[model samples]
Target: NNFSKSQSNFMDTMLVFSSGTDIRNLRQISAEIESKKGALVENQYRLRKSEVELRRKMRDFNNMKDDAESDPFDVEIMEIEIQEAINSRNGARTYIEAALKTILCMKQQYDAILKNKGIEDVTEIDFENEEEEFHIKKSTQQAFEDIVASGRISVGNNRYLLQIGIMPNLVHDYWIKFLGSPNSYEKKKFDEAREALYQQLKGSAIKEANTRGLDELFYENSCVRIEHRK
Candidate 1:
């Protein structure tokens, strides 16, 4: 009977040790997951920054291409910057993918530990759509119409103004008309003039729209339309 109790005690002690070890491993893995998520967020930021820079550089290059005063060396530098930004953005995407894989493996291990312990496994999820509250009052609708009428586009945390890729008739009718002019010399002048006005609106119309209360959802959709126009 004494030998039996001893054996049972030994088994119970081993079980406790195993449980403790598993818990410690879970804590370690959780820490690693948190670290990896932070890295993923950083990479996302880098990707956006790189994309915005590349887009700006390309626009600048296009606008300056026909300018008599624009230097070839400067254009070459812009091309190099754009290429470097592309490489950096691609590297950020690769890092994010690798980080996701590592985190996924760690999560699987964590889940396995939960199953072994007979503990309920809980998973947390976040949705981008849930990030912002959508408010669509009548005034907000009015503001959205105001923005649409103005042909203005804006985005970012504080709603900084950005240029629409495709110019509306309200904004660039003259450019379209000039491009289609019958006189070859007029078309040539229009081409060489570098029509810098077509690039983007100078200021955010969002603030003006905000007076009537801009519909956040509509604003987001409008921004999407502006982004995909070209």
Candidate 2:
């Protein structure tokens, strides 16, 4: 959205510059966008690494499941592997979903530029429409792992109360929250809740939780700190 807004500003600058308006502001904005472009690229690269790791785990699980008939313990171990693979897969999926937004945002930015160039209308661009897949059995187990891993996943009691999985309640909540919101607000809420989740994902929880509301770092205690008065 910011990119699109900036593109609009670029159009305005075209007229303003011709009428003796300075391009200094436009230059600054362009530089800022360029810096953001670099950061987004870096993030995309990191996400690709995560994607590769997840794909490898998925392959490992498939191979193990294929070989599960060899031993009694093999099925059990393979199931565990499958569950881990699901977790990694979901994590990577979450990252990809977030990154796709950037791509969409960039597309809009480009579209906005075109609009200013006298384009009448724009087509709806689908930057990401493909849904991620998970083994149904594994996903059924994901709720439990989420509860086990995070100690949260709320299940609906209004149903049969068939006792679906361990911490069934939290699992439902996890799925609900995951599907319900794609905005940064939900991401922040998830981060806050994750602070109290299980230990395995503490690193991820903290990393996400640490993202600030603004680019500026707020320090409570520092050599030089700025205090805002109410």
Candidate 3:
């Protein structure tokens, strides 16, 4: 009987121990499940965020595609307009250059005529004696006055006139002196200086032409060859 009673007490103690172990295992399983649920929720949130960003990018790309399709000729039209502007600029430049060349030729002819008439200095010429022959016409003077009053003598359309107007009288005096120089040494010095200036201008023009990728043959054909008088 005592052995039977002892065995029953030992069995009761073992059952309580087993019950405590089962409770601890259950708590651990519940904690693990809660942790897994939290991780799944976070992953789902990240996935939704990525999906939203992808949709936004796709929408932007579609909008850009629609815009491009709506105006397929936009780029071509811009190119044509740019080409037209370049052509217009080139035409204006050519016109201005021609006008300047004409003016320079006229001035050279006038200087030659004066030199032939034994006029060394235009400023020293007796204007009173030749007033009837070379006086400015009233109509011409009035037109000049009107143009000045209208402020039309600008660098754009009247660039040649502006250049002539801005040049000092001393320039003409110096040219006259150089031309009437008695010594061959002075004439040679002036010729050398003029040649140097021409070379500098030619170099600048060549540099500009090269930068624009102009055809060498076309540039050479367009250039006026200078003939230096011996």
Candidate 4:
């Protein structure tokens, strides 16, 4: 149950985080590398909040410890010492709860986005007419060109995206099956793709990791975009 639940949550997180950047950087670009959603955003916030709590607690704790050293038998020092731990624990619990809630909220949001985006089958997707796109180098395009191109794909310049040559569901399932952990494996595979890409692009100017998930396919320089059929 834990494995299945974890896998499901991992997929959910992937989709949720894939919604793109925060409000500050909302414009779609072709250079995005990682997909966003769960641990990426949620863990980041949780870390920041926890850091603040920890710093505040440590400062207060250190001050109390100093006071205790000055008055070794002070009863108030003992009380303060206990309270400091309690405060830290309380802060951590609050952050944990908030992080969990944020994930739950993202789950709801992603599901809604899928429905709204008309992603009938999360597997087969067409890049044109789709707002999101994941760009890749011309090499990755060969695999895609053979299978997905079908006269429906377009190639562009500065192409250095690790696109979803296969749909998210397929990619998601494959990672979980092979590596036994979706989150960790997906990131690992992404890294692998980078290694492969680097070798492929040797002597070539390093291009950005450009990608924007779309509901359909379209054209832009050498970037190849393909459309999925119903």
User: Could you tell me the lDDT of residue 66 within candidate 2?
Assistant: 74
Provide the TM-score for each candidate, comma-separated. Answer: 0.44, 0.26, 0.27, 0.29
Arrange candidates by lDDT, highest first: which order? Answer: 1, 2, 4, 3
Clashes of each: 0, 9, 0, 37
| Best TM-score among the predictions, by candidate number | 1
Sort every candidate by TM-score, greatest first.
1, 4, 3, 2
Tens-place lDDT per residue, model 2, 1-230, is 24222344445345422211112322333444466666667756765776676677667667766774667576568677657656765555554555455445544554555566565433212111110111112333445345545555434331212221123354456555544566424646654443333322223222332453332222224434568999
**lDDT per residue (tens digit) for residues 188-210 in model 3:** 67545444333333333334445
* Predicted candidate 1 versus true structure: per-residue lDDT over 54-145, tens digit per residue: 89988998877878899999989988888988898777777777777766766777788789988774322111132121111111222333
What's the lDDT for residue 162 in model 4?
31
Candidate number of the best lDDT: 1
For candidate 2, the clash count comes to 9
Residue-by-residue lDDT tens digits, candidate 4, 1-230: 23212335455446524433222112221112123334346546655765676677667656766774656555456566557656655655554555455455555554565566665423212333233222333333343343333422233311222333333333223323433435334656655653454344442222221334342243453364567699
Residue 153's lDDT within candidate 4 is 27
lDDT of 1 at 188: 51
Lowest-scoring 10 consecutive residues by lDDT in candidate 2? 126-135
